[model samples]
Target: MQIDVLIDVKTTLGEGPLWDVQEQRLYWIDSVDGRVFRATADGSEIRAWQVPQKIGSMALRKNGGAIVALARGVHFLDLNTGDVELINDPEPNLKNNRLNDGKVDASGRFLFGSMDTLEDGPNGALYRLDADLTVHKLQDGIVVSNGPCWSPDGKTFYFSDTWSGEIWAYDYDVEMGSISNRRVFAVLQGENFRSSDGSTVDEEGGLWNAQVYEGKLVRYAPDGTIDRAIPMPVKNVTSVMFGGENLDTLFVTSMARPPLSRFPTDSVQGGSVFKITGLGVRGLPEHRFAG
Candidate 1:
């Protein structure tokens, strides 16, 4: 496999690499910078818009525009005008909590989780936004939420709490957009221990996770066993997604400024988005938010 910097733009906290199949473009966000970016698969014609608050994730809308999870709550973003209308604040009372990583399910519902701004307590929760624009809380007692994804058959859901050092799997109900039977899918331990930042599933059911602060892309088989681990050029790798014409190229996003004091700020290509080819694998097309 070969990897190289695709976009040289520097972002404070780059996360949420999203591949748009219909539009044949890639979307990503600078979490702490409140910036949303879009570009062709070749990393050209890049366009970025600044949100009013820090952004966690963004989903393409079936009709148009996008649904963005900002620091305050969920909002409908008009990319052309850079106007955002608040949908709802599921945690209006949680002063220290903010919405985080999220993804669209096969049924067109957007599922995302919250994280504590202080990263101190388990003050966060998981939520789902349906097609009717209604929000529902799915799970609670999370510290830092990240990596929301599903299996190929839509039966298994994967999520992680970054500070908890664990990635959990849930039995997902595709039709109802509900999750249950929460269990540990994998633990970050041993010599390779590192926090899970973001993830994407391959067509063959292998989950590729970016191990933040560890500079590695680790793939776990469907059974939660480590399939392989590929070292990254940057130490603060944030997220990954499969883009390109054949959906075989892996797009990676990173961070230039470390969030915590423990991580070094000076790292090679820290904020550059990367492209990986020769993986010999493809990813399923991302689902659009029905709302």
Candidate 2:
């Protein structure tokens, strides 16, 4: 099936793309532009929300708000009023670090990662936010930590260290909130694609990952086998998510960043949200922040 461009957002550095089932809307962020956007499934009724700093990701809450990963901390955002209150700040001393890709686990806890903004910093770290707003460091020394998807049964965790070019899986104990037995799940075998970015797991436990710098979205089986490839019209495919009433519609977000000399024209689908219909399995409902 041919993928169609739904909307031309023209984002500078588009990243997190999420689906809000209750509201039947899509939410995403422009990390560099510090803007959060929401729109309908057909790319209508677009609205932009301004944030004080760069936003990495956002998860809806059960109580009619959202939990957002801000520059260096997590905040509780009032959906109706747009008021943001800081909840927790990890690595406040690290001036060159900021929150990156993230999502809420099935248990409603937020799992996010940080990356080094400074050129020579020691990579980054992955963290988990518990029910009481306590942040715990799960993994460290990650260059660009992305994807944090859970299997259909919640038995496995799929994540990517974007600079490593490999997707890793871990045995997850949902009740205990722990991950162990880490193993490589898949690796991108191309020179143009440096690593995997945001990803989502389908109902059949398949992974759909955005191939950054390669301008493609790839589907893979649970056993680390390639299933199919969906090409995008632009480089820097940042993230993907399944939405729509039946959850069979795939939404993709891309970016138009530096090194413009390589691609002279900005006329491509650089910063737009594209949609592919009838090509995805239903995704698990997003966990809401109850606390």
Top-lDDT structure, candidate number: 1
- Candidate 1 lDDT over residue span 182-242, tens digit each: 9999887535446899999999999999998888889999999998899888878999999
Query: What TM-score would each prediction reach against the true structure?
Result: 0.97, 0.94
User: Residue-pair clashes per candidate, as listed?
Assistant: 0, 0
lDDT for each candidate structure? 0.92, 0.83
- Model 1 scores worst on lDDT over the 10 consecutive residues at 186-195
Provide the RMSD of all predictions against the true structure, rounded to 1 decimal: 1.2, 2.0
Q: Tell me the spans in candidate 1 whose CA falls farther than 4 Å from its real position.
A: 190-193
Once superposed on the true structure, which residue ranges of model 2 sit more than 4 Å away at CA? 118-121, 258-267
lDDT of 2 by residue, 34-78 (tens): 788999999999988888888888888877878888887988888
Q: What is the lDDT of residue 227 in candidate 1?
A: 89
